[model samples]
Target: MRKLLLRSFYRIYQSVFKMAMPFLPWRRPVLLEGAGSIKKLPGLLEELKIKNVLIVTDSTLMKLGLLDNLIKELGINGCKYAIYDQTVPDPTIENVEEALKLYHKHNCKAIIAFGGGSPMDCAKIVGARVSRPKMPIEKMKGVLKVIFKIPTLIAVPTTAGTGSEVTLAAVISNSVTHEKYPINDFCLIPHYAVHDPELTLKLPSHITSMTGMDAMTHAVEAYIGRSNTKETKKAALEAIALIHQNLLKAYTTPGDIQARAAMLKASYLAGVAFTRAYVGYVHAIAHTIGGFYGIPHGLANAIIMPHVLEYYGSAANGKLAELADHLGIGKGSQSTDQKANAFIQYLKEMNQKMNIQSNIEQIEEKDMPEMISRALAEANPLYPVPRVLFEEELKELYYKIKG
Candidate 1:
């Protein structure tokens, strides 16, 4: 009875969201694309008259000197910038606070998120903190909390996944409780998105595979979810097709600029889709696992996605079959169930070929309860998942993915 009531509430909430979607203040970042797009950002900063900026990234990028060209160009364009390279995977509230300090110290007029999703998440929250100084990060945990205008945020994605460049949601982990949650608001969307495939040219094969699968998960979840708009469905389908064509090529040939560029575009399109349509159980489960075990977000999503989709069973069959048909995965004579199963099998095979583990070895039996609780809290009434899951069903999924 309780589960049924919750399901009804979720459906009503989703319906209301769908009706309000057209009137929402939806915006997309001004895009800069192609091989040399990162180089163009400094000129954009100059044109915006942004003399001081904050660059949020991670130590790995700094070690690789990936920021060298951008840093040099910023100097040439007379844009003074402060660097905060302490962001970690599944960035914490502390990361945002530290970066916010740098933003203030430098009197930054804008922010540049220069790496993968962690840095982008950190930068977005920092901008949110800048916009709402009195409100704590905890208070902004759910939707539409940060309605005020954030400072100009320029997202420069060095990876081909996560789509943090075009997303309005930022996931942040609470270090003390080990809880991961998303803060969603239109205000958090970046003012600019610079896609430079050159930056992703040297991505390690494992990272490439994991991030590509991450983009795939976004596209799949957004397309299968209930609250999709026509525009979002179109974006998700395009992203799905691009990932099908380019992920493997980009993984095998890191220097293949064309493949890398395609994957980047796919990531951006998936971001666009999921930001409005929203993601489902895959993201919800991945966030909890990432928070509890310090697992990489992309890797967690890659492993858990198949399990959740398979568990959704008949509820997800029609959409999954449609995707299978779109990808030409199964014969025309196959039933919807067969096609759906084929699609899930294809993901598993891709994982095997890329050497991605089928199970997350980091997930522990002792952590199952809290993980399920967190995952349920994140997804219920908000995600508009194909099928609503209760405790026992969610627990079964945890067991299935256990190492």
Candidate 2:
């Protein structure tokens, strides 16, 4: 009876979104992709007439000297910039306010995010805060809440996951309360995205595996979710294919330029698709895990992906079968359910090969109720889950992923 009610509710929700969202406007970023694409940044910056850019990154990249060439080019070309390399793993709102102060003090004309998702998410919020000085950044939470367009923003993702470069949303944490809040607006999308594989060559193997699976999760959920368009479907399919072909190679050979490029492309495509289609319960659950436990977002998503699929079961059969067909796994005799299970098995094997754990050691049984409630709050009325998760089911699901 509860499942029936949930299904009925979702049908109405799907109807409203399907009717309205196709007409919604989307932002596209100018993409620079290749081995030496970072060199093009100077010319692009000059073309945009951007001066005194704020570089939002973390200390690790600075320590590795990965930004040396780009920083040198900016200086040699006479573009003034300030570096805020203090962005932590999961960026919080309090520190983003600090970055905003730096942006204002430096009088930065543009914002350049130069690390992984953490820096990019921080930069997006900082841009929003700086753009509308009178409005509280907290008010910009939820969809289309920002009233002002941010300064020209450029993102260079060092990790192949997160797809924070092209996505029209950012996730920022409330550290004190341990709540993860999202800022969703078209204005948050970066004006330009640079996906130079050379920057990704130095990524550790575990990071490559986890982040590659993160991209895979994005593509899979986007393809399966209810918010898909024809364009999103195509991009998602392409992303899935590319990830399948290249993720293992990139994981095994971190220095392989071609494989790295393919993973980057896959991540970009997945981002574009999910930006439109949004993601499902995996992200909703993963976001809560991140907020509560400080688990890396990509790793959480990878760990939760197969379990969500298994839980969704028959309701997810059709789309999962489609993916199986795309992956060349199912023949004529295999049923859709069989194909879906095969896909789930494939994900398990993939995780094992990549050394991704099926469970998180840090998650506690005591926190299960909070996690379940928070996940439900985040997912309902937004995510088009194939199967609507009730509290009873959610508790059981969380138990499987707990240490």
Candidate 3:
């Protein structure tokens, strides 16, 4: 009876939210796509009359000199810039705070999120902190909390996955509490997205595989969830097709610019889809694991996604079957169950081929309770998942994925 009442409440909340979706302030970033597109950003900055900016990125990217070209172009364009390269994977609140300090110290007029999702997430939250100086980051935890407009934010993705360039979410972690959550608002969306495939050419094969699978997870979650709009569904399908065609090619041949470009576009589209439609338990659970154990977000999603889909069982069959057909995976004569299983099998095989672990070895048994609690807290009454699970079912999932 308690479970039934809770589920009914969740559905009712989701229904009301879906009805309001069309009225939400949805916006897309101005895209600078194609090869050498990173070169276009300095001119955009100049046009915007932004003289000082902060570049938020991870130290690895800075050490590799990946920002050399952008830095040079900014200087040539007469723009002053400050670098905050301390962002780590599953960016912490400290990362945002540190970057915010840099933004203030340099009197930055804008923010440039360079590198992958971590940097992007950090940069977005830094913008949020700047906008709401009095409000704590924890106060802006859920949807539409950052009502104030952020600064002139630009996203430059050095990786083909995470799709942070087009997303309105900034996933932040509380290192002390072992909690991870997303702060979502239309204002968090970057003003411009610079997609330059050249930057992704040097990505190692493993990073490519993990991030590609991350994009796939986003597309799949958005398609299977109940809150999708027509536009979101269309973007999800296109993203899925692109990932199916390009992920393996990009993985096997790291320097294939065409494949890299396709994957990058796919990531951007998936970002668009999920940013509006939202993700499900896979993301919820993955975020918890990432926060608790500091696991790579993409790696956790890849391992946990299959398990969550299998748990959804009949509830997800129709959508999974449709995806299977889209991927040309099953015969017309096959049952929906067979087709769905085949699709799941394909994901598992892809993981194996890419050397992605089937299970996360980092999950500890003792952490299961807190992880499950955090995952449930993140999903319920928020994510419009196809099938919702409470404690027992979520516990089973944690144990299944535990190494």
Clashing pairs in 1: none
C-alpha lDDT of residue 164 in model 1? 86
Q: lDDT of each prediction vs. the true structure? A: 0.93, 0.88, 0.92
Report the error of model 2 at residue 44, Å: 1.3
For model 1, the stretches where C-alpha displacement exceeds 4 angstroms are none
> Backbone collision count in every prediction?
0, 0, 0
Q: Candidates' TM-scores?
A: 0.99, 0.96, 0.99
lDDT of 3 by residue, 1-403 (tens): 9999999999999999899988988788899989999989999998999999999999999888889999999999999999999999999999998899999999999999999999999999999999999999999998889989999999999887798889899999999998999999999999999989999999989899999999999999999999998999999999999999999999999889999999999999999999988899999999998998888899888999898999899999899999999989988999999999999999999899999998887788898889888888889988999997999999998888874
What lDDT is obtained when candidate 2 is compared to the true structure? 0.88
TM-score of 2: 0.96
User: Which candidate leads the pack in lDDT?
Assistant: 1
Model 1, 64-116: lDDT tens digits are: 98899999998898889999999999999999999999899889999999999
lDDT of 2 at 106: 91
Q: After the best TM-score superposition of candidate 3, give how far the Cα of residue 210 lies from its true spot, in angstroms.
A: 0.6
